[model samples]
Target: MRSVYMQSLAYVDANRIYSRIMELGEIGRTKQSGVQRLALSKEDKEAQILVTKWMEEAGLTVSHDHFGNLIGRKEGEKPHLPIVMIGSHIDSVRNGGKFDGIIGVLGGIEIAQFIYSNNISHAHTLEVIAFCEEEGSQFNDGLFGSRGMVGKATEEDFQKKNDQQVTRFDALKNFGSEIDPARYKESVRKEEEIKIYLEMHIEQGPYLDVNSHPVGIVNGIAGLSWYTIMIEGTPGHAGTVPMNLRNDPMIGAAKVIQEINEICSSQPDQQTVGTVGIIQAFPGGSNIIPNAVQFSLDLRDINLTRKNRIFAEIEERLQAICQENGLSYTIKTNIELDPVACSEEIIDVFTSIGKKLDMDIPIMVSGAGHDAMLMSEITDIGMIFVRCKKGISHQPEESATKEDIAMGTEIMLQAVLQYI
Candidate 1:
């Protein structure tokens, strides 16, 4: 294939990208054609193996860090200079869409492949990463790999459990990971080591599609928080226990979950949103009053102060509701991230490149958390959003046109060229 450039404008073979996407999507495919490739699972490992092979085919040296992050690097003339990094996560949520995070990884690899095959020269080392556990679908603390890379993930974070009652620590161990609490820093990248982070992803929202734009420049990412709610009560026979005399933890959990919806909907900021991902009741029998209940809450907002303030009210409401139900509960915060803005300088670069390519690049906001969010801790970050069909994501129906994928990939390539 020829280099994807016409007089310095970015271009690439979208068929190659789409073909690889379909190949990878075959792994962990659900009956509905969605993906069930949770982090640290066999499927996730299988994905790593396949993508690693592709990385090698692109003539990049590949390495896996202690945190399970896959890094593919090609040294530049000035190898000592901070690297230009590109990528997104490969892990998927249960029954997730095929194009959500897959395009970014494949697109990044295509860029490296182009650089290698065309013998493009640059001054800074180029790296492409496949970050692990960004979905947090299994472990519940998302961005585990990126967090670890920046020294933000802790031993406790690795020890988190999934709905199957499997601790992530044990899962990682079973998946062939040798994690030592003391050695976590080994995966960390110092601020000076990273010049900037670039990610290409499906918009996961309707903005670009509805606006009839093929690609978007992300200006900011919404702040998000994940919490686990554990409620305790006395278990009793459903038939024998009178409603007034029984302490039902399930009842308490219901109230708190409902209040989350109520509070988020009532918030003056329409962007504030909350969702319950998983809920489990102990002694889950039709005839038994639940003695324990555990559930997770996902809350997001672009406004930090307002989100925090709303969370406080929700906390008090949880306490009051639990007391009313004659129950006790604890809400443990799993992860909390403040809103992060993309680098303005990089945004300008993208805008300028878009103009040069004669492509309309819409500026937008990302409501989802990404590896790019955590990478912002160590360096400037930028993102390219491809328009997905109907702006749908995280579902089997999630999709993006090849044209949009090509547009987004070109933006990523141009950004890399500018940085290098």
Candidate 2:
């Protein structure tokens, strides 16, 4: 293999990679320019088809797993060697930006194209992947595909329903990627030789954009906990129920969410943040007092001890509110994700690659979750970040410059060259 020009790699048909990103983003574009390709949605399946076609055109063997993850393998000099994987989720949140997860997977594809043209061959296999269902937009099941890969998903998970329109099993079946019952008990990492897992994504925050950096190396990811709360109360006519007499769950819920924010806010420098994303009452009409209210709370922090402390404070606050309001409440933690630290070895390699290419790069932590977090539990993981215009994500305004994408791809190309 010839030596990479490093900086010149950014100019190698850079427009082509950007064009491909735009093309793929258009497949699931909603009315607001936000992407709508929720996991296993028809849009997601279509995007898979399109990328698979491109992978085949790139002369890579492509296939889908039981979890619907699209894997495109570019065989290296040694077919049996451990694989070097680079990718991110293909599914997007509702009204999400085009470049968030797409950049990573598409960037991997672009890297494969660059390697092919350069005739670079490694002793190990290289795979460009598009992980399915990372967002949990369609069904509140985050990192479904990666969870399956790590053998975390159970048989009961298949029975979970999404708004009565889709079941996990049904969605997989629709995509022709259904998992057998027996496979549920099988291991995801059949081979213990995975060298490293790499992901390239937009910073999804203002750090890189504000700092004027084109590329970033991720050091860690924040811990996350999602919980659902339900408060039950007696129903009554709005006008007839006195404020003190009424067991209004809505009032209690409002107080709880407010207190949750206040508690987490008391932490140092806002290390903890909580959001009650969804809230609704049983008697949603204006004429009646709400008998019950259901809501969800998402809490996140970089430290696990602080995360737990915040959660405890939230629970205590909610219990007090319900007690004072004379209402019954139930809480269930839907998911708990521990903070993940990237491998120092992988981080050094990425940093060295950036310096070798004279790219301005800095170390950072991800505020959002990615499949990389899960992959870290199984093997050494590394991440590259391209800057978004305003550090905005999960919205239509999210934007990344072509130069940033090209630079990230160049860094990844160098890393892959050394890693594989």
Candidate 3:
């Protein structure tokens, strides 16, 4: 293929990128055409091997850090300059769509391939990374790989046990990785060694597609918190207990759920969102009143203070409801992630390139968490989002057209060139 330049960078091969995406999707192929390559699973290992091979074929040197982050590096004219890093994770949730994290990793490879094939020389070295586990589907600890790289991961973090009683340390050892808790800090890259970080991902929401835009330049990632609530009450026979006399926990739980919705809806900030996704009632039968109910609550906002304030309101209302319903409750927090803003300098690069390419690119906030969120701690970070069909993700139906993927890749390549 003849070299096509956008300013000074060569246009990425759309066909080559799409083909590699399909190839990676086939590794953990589910019956429904989804993926199940949970982190450190056999399938995840296979996918890593394949990606490593592709990186080598693209004329990049491949290496793995103590934290299991796979890195591929290409030397630049000035090896002393800080490296320009690009990448995303490859691990998938159970039966998740193929495009969630695959696009960014493969897209980075495509850029390296373009550079190598065209003999383009850059000033700073380039590194493409395939993060180990960003979905947290396995250990329920999201951003595990990037967390290690930024020196945010603790020994306690690795001690967490999954549902099967498998600790993260054991899982890594089982997956053929060498583990030394003492060396985790050594894996962290110094702030001065990284010039910038960029990741290209699917929007995972319908905003861009609905607005008829092909690209989304991310402005920030939302902060999120998860809680498990349990309500306890007395159980009685359905036939024997009168409706007015019975102490039903489910009733209190229902009231709490409704109040949660109200609090979130009444928030002046439109970016705040609340969800109650999981519910379980004890004595779940036609002839008994439920004595206990357990449910999960997810709260998110781009503003950390606003999100915490909303959560406080939820707790206050929930306490009142429990007292009125004669039920006792307990709440436990599972996860807490702070909001992160994207670098304005990198955002300008994307915006400038979008205008030159004649594409309508809008600056937007991301409601989802990514490796880029954790990477923000160590260096300047930016993101490019492609349109996904129906804005659906984490399921079998998650999708992005080849044309949109190609567009995102081109924008990412151009941004890298400009930055380098």
Candidate 4:
């Protein structure tokens, strides 16, 4: 342990890691000065190559899986030891910030560099992976890479195409690689293979930055449910449609949206949130009474019971509104993802390291989902939270200071030492 600590102190240069992140930030900037490296795009593939180069320079054995996730492994004395995995996604939403996902990947690489330089030997290996996609901005699929690795993805999901009509399998081929039809199941990491997993990411919200806390120890990830609500009614000329004589789906939709918001507001707060992200009207013209309206509802909560209750309330309210208005409607839940809790054992290690470093690490729940959520299913998982400037993400303006990132990186290194 003394040797490991000395190894970390000797080779871990926070500023160097910071420079690398800033440099990568320049390579993938969008025209708007945001980021645009969505899943399988030319930019995304190029970033993979760049990081793989760094992996080689760090002296780790590097390879990519059938899912396109890049893994860099540092072998320990015992080759068959269970690995301590650390990584996050490299893909971003349109105009996303730099630190959202890449921080974990880079931090892990830095740790591996330190281990190699100090000749630190351990029973467990350190594995750093760059998840292919976490943001579903370009493709309709999110966590595609992680899901494929864990064998959670179905054949139908692989068949689903992106905006370019490129299937997930074909998208990999476009990058000069092909998915083995038989090896899809081999992608999942068995429970015995991974001892633990840790990820470092920007808070992506204002809590830590506003509170003047330098870091956050995440407690659990929120569960989410999404549904598309379609309302059907008779379309008629606006001038001819009498107020009382017409069956108006638009009117019902408005009432339902209002009720949905109010119901969510009325619930006991446990980090529960609801949103209506998309709304569309058929024949959306000023002069025509809308005959059809489709909208999407997203409900999320850290506590599973609260999420289910809110979801049920919205469904009941929508049904009542449609029946009362005599309008035909349909509600389809596109996805209902379960919540994930972090490993208490791993969380304790993070907290202990933060104390030794004299960092004020607050405990918080991640409102947004992440690759860590998927990794948690197979391993004991932990996360390090760097403070974002304004607690904002998924935009060109999303920012985090260099100092905050450096602080998180050092803390992460300490945690790696303890884990190994």
Report the lDDT tens digits of candidate 4 across residue range 146-180.
77777677777667678778887777656645445
User: Candidate 1 regions off by >4 Å?
Assistant: 1-7, 161-182
Local distance difference test, each candidate: 0.87, 0.82, 0.88, 0.80
- Answer with 1 or 3, whichever has the higher lDDT: 3
How many collisions per candidate?
1, 1, 0, 3
Please list the Cα RMSD from the true structure of every candidate, rounded to 1 decimal place: 2.5, 2.0, 2.8, 2.4
Per-residue C-alpha lDDT of model 3 across residues 1-420, encoded as one tens digit per residue: 333344743377888888988899999999999999998888999998999999998889998776778899999889999989998999999999899989999999999988888787788899999997898888876788898998888888788887789888777766655545447788888888899999999999999989988889999999988788999999999899988997899999999999999988987757888999779989688788998999999899999989999998999998998899899999988777899999999999899888888766999999998899889888999999999999999998998989899999999998887666
**How well is each residue in 30-131 modelled by candidate 2, as lDDT tens digits?**
899888888888888888888888787666789777777788998878777788999897788887888878888888887788777777656788888888
- Candidate 2 lDDT at 196 equals 87
Off by over 4 Å in 3: 1-10, 178-182, 234-247, 280-292
Ranking by lDDT: 3, 1, 2, 4
What TM-score, over all chains together, does every model reach? 0.94, 0.95, 0.91, 0.92
Per-residue CA lDDT of model 1 for 1-420, tens digit only, reads 333343575458889899889888999999999988998888988998899899999989998777778889999789889999998988898999888888989999998988888888888899999987899888767898899999898778867788888887677656644444346678799999999999999999888888899889999999999998899999999999888898899888888988999999997748898999889999799999988999998999999999999899999999998888788988888899999999999999899889988876888888999999999999999999998889889999999988789888887887787787
Q: Give me candidate 1's TM-score against the actual structure.
A: 0.94
